[model samples]
Target: MDLVSTSREALRIGAVSYLNSKPLVHGLTALEGAQVRFDLPSRLADDLSAGRLDVALVPIVEYLRHPEYQLLSSACVACWGPVLSVKLYFRTPPEEVQRLALDEGSRTSAALAQILLAQLHDVRPQLVQLPIGDSIDDVEADAVLLIGDRAMQTSDDQFAEVWDLGDRWCRWTELPFVFAAWVARPDLPVHASQLADVFDSVRDRGVAAIESIVAAEAANLGLEPALVRDYLTRYLHFTLAKREQLGVELFAKHCRELGLVEASRSSLEHSS
Candidate 1:
């Protein structure tokens, strides 16, 4: 049996649209069995939960919300510390902040920010939900959390502090952050694992071709190719490992405290 390409059906897979995610999609080419569908995590989660996808690379928060998904082996889009890609720019101190405007690309970051501010900082900041194209400056929110590619190029004006959610989480909880994960619906047929293999392969290819990915996608995001390359190879991580495990547990705990989910670590684990 080959590790790649066994099934003929296309496996609907959701992928992030940022360069940090380049490696994951790049690695899918080695798969011989599944066809993948790529989209922003928000739409992917909606579709996946609606029974449109078999397996997907989705936001970690999505996995947190849906206990019905099983995580794939040895793969995640995580970062040990400061993830420059997921940043929260503020116009006031963390304590003084009253409201937050969220980027629409990923709702997970918004949830994380609200919970972190409340639990860790003991501040009940109001959350103002806004779509992706909404200008952070125009919003009356004291802070704005932006994620993925659009966030990477955000101008640093009108904020007193810049916080990377990943870094803040690590500092507060001393664990790495699993921003995204490869997950499958619970009781998914054995054939669905074909999509899992596709995700793994493309992720490897993406990692190997970071230079090319940055060269191609950076300009569109208004960041230099070299900077994007550094962020991919140095700032971002592509594995689901030790620190990532800690991140998942910690994140799960935080989510629970925020009333986002009630699932425990033991219950969240899906044997692959």
Candidate 2:
């Protein structure tokens, strides 16, 4: 089934509104014959699924779940270590956790939190949703997962244990972790190569303008420019290369083992 229009129309691009995603979407609005929309990571996934978006930066888990999606570009939101934006706070010991509350804004990080807990401690706790705009205080659970800007601002003083999911994954697997990627639905009106180039070009420009991006975004996110700069440069990795691809494959394997995604289908489609 064709998911996109047959006629040439403005490409509908969706991106996350978080600070971590700024580098990937910088100057994207200037693309010829393209329209870009900013949304939550999870919402972007939904929009892509419903054919409302031609391509979107969606959670890696979302891509793994849908066999029809193709990796549209090398641009991705990844982390080598200590991402400082995706965190798990444990009120009780990890192994003893009986209930885990997941942030409504996350799909990939929620799965990662479960996978890490099960792999490291052999625990599979019951899951609960921490609705958008709600905090850990509003959720009754042994542990809570938080992502994006909110996770960075959260304090760890009250938690028994705080885990930066990216750091934990790297320490456990010795590989980088890919959280989200630019994915496109099958059978688009545009050539895959052409669209991929547009996405990659914007990503390169965005990465090169990180300093200016930090300068513009810091005050808006209520973060100091230094911290934002370090977060972008030190904690986050914007390109999805060989190591990052390995990370995605490994994550898909874990998701399969844990029954988080369909086990019978190939989970990724790399761009040619």
Candidate 3:
């Protein structure tokens, strides 16, 4: 069926357009009763909260922000260490940094940056939101937070210090960090378990098609295919297993301590 026809009857699923997400949603459109659409990570959270999307790959922090939403699948956009994609470029040392320009496409990364800066570095910079494509020169910040494609494309030498939040979190807590997860709204038109099965199947297919996904996305993002493949296979952790669940709980604990989210501890656990 065409998009218009699918939009009305199928479950609306929000897909991220970043290269990191390409593998997760590969061949997802081929799934029946599910209509996939693309949007930024932050927008997906908004759409899901507003009831525009039945399910979405939303920022992990969004799940904490909205406790009513149920995690729909075992697949996630996660990382164990040094995720080259989520970076904080700083011209000044972490403690001296007083201002930060944030990527508008981020919600989880932005909040994670805050948590890290406050607790880890003892710094509380004023955050200013900027478009994802905006240049670092556009705002005079001591540090800048970039996520997704833009973060991947950035060079390390451009900044005095580059802090990968994933690496930092892993080193500090020795646990994987879940950046995004597939979550469904409280009241859905479709059954939650059925949605989970379809999404899990799609995730498996997507992971199996990694080579094709890397080749196609490399051309679009202007990156080397080998590097893209390594990043996908090595850096990006897509499974939400026991350790990943522990990561979510730890992250939620930090978020709660920072007063960033109102969710209870159990809300961080993925619902089967």
TM-score of decoy 1: 0.89
lDDT tens readout by residue for model 3, 105-127: 99999989999999888988887
Displacement of residue 266 (Cα, Å) in model 3 is 2.5
lDDT of candidates 1 onward, in order? 0.73, 0.89, 0.85
Tens digits of per-residue lDDT, candidate 1, 128-218, equal 7668667776678888888887777787765798888888877888877787777788746455455455456667767888777888887
**What is the TM-score of each predicted model, taking all chains together?**
0.89, 0.94, 0.94
* lDDT measured at residue 30 in model 3 versus the true structure, 0 to 100: 82
lDDT of 3: 0.85
**Residue 225 CA error for candidate 2 (Å)?**
1.1
Residue pairs whose backbone atoms clash in candidate 1: 5-32, 5-33, 23-206, 26-202, 27-201, 27-202, 27-203, 28-202, 90-159
Candidate 3 wrong stretches, greater than 4 Å: 1-8
Question: How many steric overlaps does candidate 1 have?
Answer: 9
Top model number, lDDT: 2
What lDDT tens digits, residue by residue, belong to model 2 across residues 72-188?
888889999999999999999999999999999899999999999999999999999998888789999999999999999999999999999999999999999999999989956
